[model samples]
Target chain A: MTHELATLEKQVADLRAKLEGIERRVPSNKLSMVVFSGDLDRALAAFIIATGAVAMGMDVVMFFTFWATPILRDPAKKVEDKDFMGKMFGTMLPKGACSVKLSKMNMGGLGTAMMKNLMKQKNVASLDQMIALAGELGVQIYVCELSMELMGFKREEMIQYPAMDFCGVAKFLEEAMDSRIQLFI
Target chain B: MSEAIHADKVMDLKGLPCPMPVVKVSKGIKEVAVGQILEAQTTDPGSLTDFPAWARTSGNEIVETIQENGIIRIFIRRKV
Candidate 1:
């Protein structure tokens, strides 16, 4: 073959490869959440947004950091290996999703109860139902290991969720970098 | 608003609030094949803006939206 033709062929192949790379590239359609609030209203908002994102056919990854990790704890499950601080933290923090207090107008738990009753009457999905829906919709949850260590939360104390794992903030950043939507709640 | 549309599926999401209506609509769109229409009927006031905005981002097409008698009906086509 001619040298000029060979050079032209190489250029064609390079262009084709670049085009293929662009064609097969993944879209920026993923959503990431940095959940830092432990309030019941905030938790409900996080899960609602999560479930809605999944419904929109977007991949959702929630990083449960800081106070948010306690929302996933199981009230009935207890570990015997906890130190004094761990035990104290476990006792003081909200045990589960259901036990979380409202960030506003808690009114000594009466406001929370009234809100729950109103939601039931309005046919709005509760926090528990939203969590189940989030799970069913394939929402991935990452518990911050650092937060868990500081808060004295054990992995075994978390509720039985399908796609939950303990990870660091780096994982949250990695997921967030590729996501189209990122929120802190 | 004056006539009825032919849709492959229909969802009556009447009392559901913000996220549920869109969530159900998103779920409902999956039940039908590509190019087919899915109609969602709701009473939620937010759905007026939600349906259009959701369809835009989700890559679905809203064929039409009808509002009458305190009911908002959104017809969407699954594009992807």
Candidate 2:
């Protein structure tokens, strides 16, 4: 009985040492978190960052608050009703690079028609595809609780994603503090 | 000797940009059969790092690499 007990103890110790070796080999730079304030410019940046991060083998979390939530809202309702072309290509060409102000640059009643033309001409991705790609690659996208309440948005209004969650600033900050790059956008 | 690919075959990826070569190579190699050689020539400097890593990740064989003058050429063979 004593010899059998010693053999089992040795086996357990070997297993623990092997597990420790595996633990040490695991890489640490695998996590990232970003916060996007409600802005079109920032939303675009966040989308690009999230896509790039996933491709580079890092886990990414993006918290959308205030103005940014609208960018993730129903693509059918939001993008179709506005001047999306000017928002994408901007106005004034070379000099007017920053002219397409999302908050101010409405093409009046002709906004929706311009968006249709732009979508057809530019071959831009729809919001649904962007969200789908983000979700497919394990990007966590959280909608801010305060922003949701302020905007009166329900869960159904947001694009469906497995990583989608509604959380407050406190939780967001806790997650963001550990990330390599935490952007307000 | 210049390794020859069949007349019906060519890896034509002109006007492709960085990080795109990896995607294109990924999609391109799928069309070639196992053990067939693929000659990948790209202008994107990122391919220097990207394609090798991709070859490693996908378990394909990178047979040869050369930098002639300013252009980069890589020869890869499908493993499985």
Q: What is model 1's C-alpha RMSD?
A: 2.5
Give the alpha carbon lDDT tens digit for every residue of A1-185 in model 2.
Answer: 99999999999999999999887665444344545454333444566567655554456888876656655555332222225443442112111111222333445525534653564454433334555767776788878887666545556655657888889878777676556566666
Give me the displacement of residue B27 in model 1, in angstroms.
1.7
Score candidate 2 by TM-score against the native. 0.52
lDDT of candidate 2 over B3-67, digit per residue (tens):
54332234755444543455456667767888887877766666678778878767797777766
Cα error of candidate 2 at position A161, Å = 1.9
Q: Count the backbone clashes (under 3 Å) in each candidate.
A: 0, 3
Interface RMSD of each: 1.2, 5.2
The local distance difference test score of model 1 is: 0.90
Query: How do the residues A57-159 of candidate 1 rate in per-residue lDDT, one tens digit apiece?
Result: 7999999989888999988998899999999999999998889989999999999999999999998898888888888889999999999999888899999
Clashing pairs in 1: none
DockQ of each: 0.67, 0.21
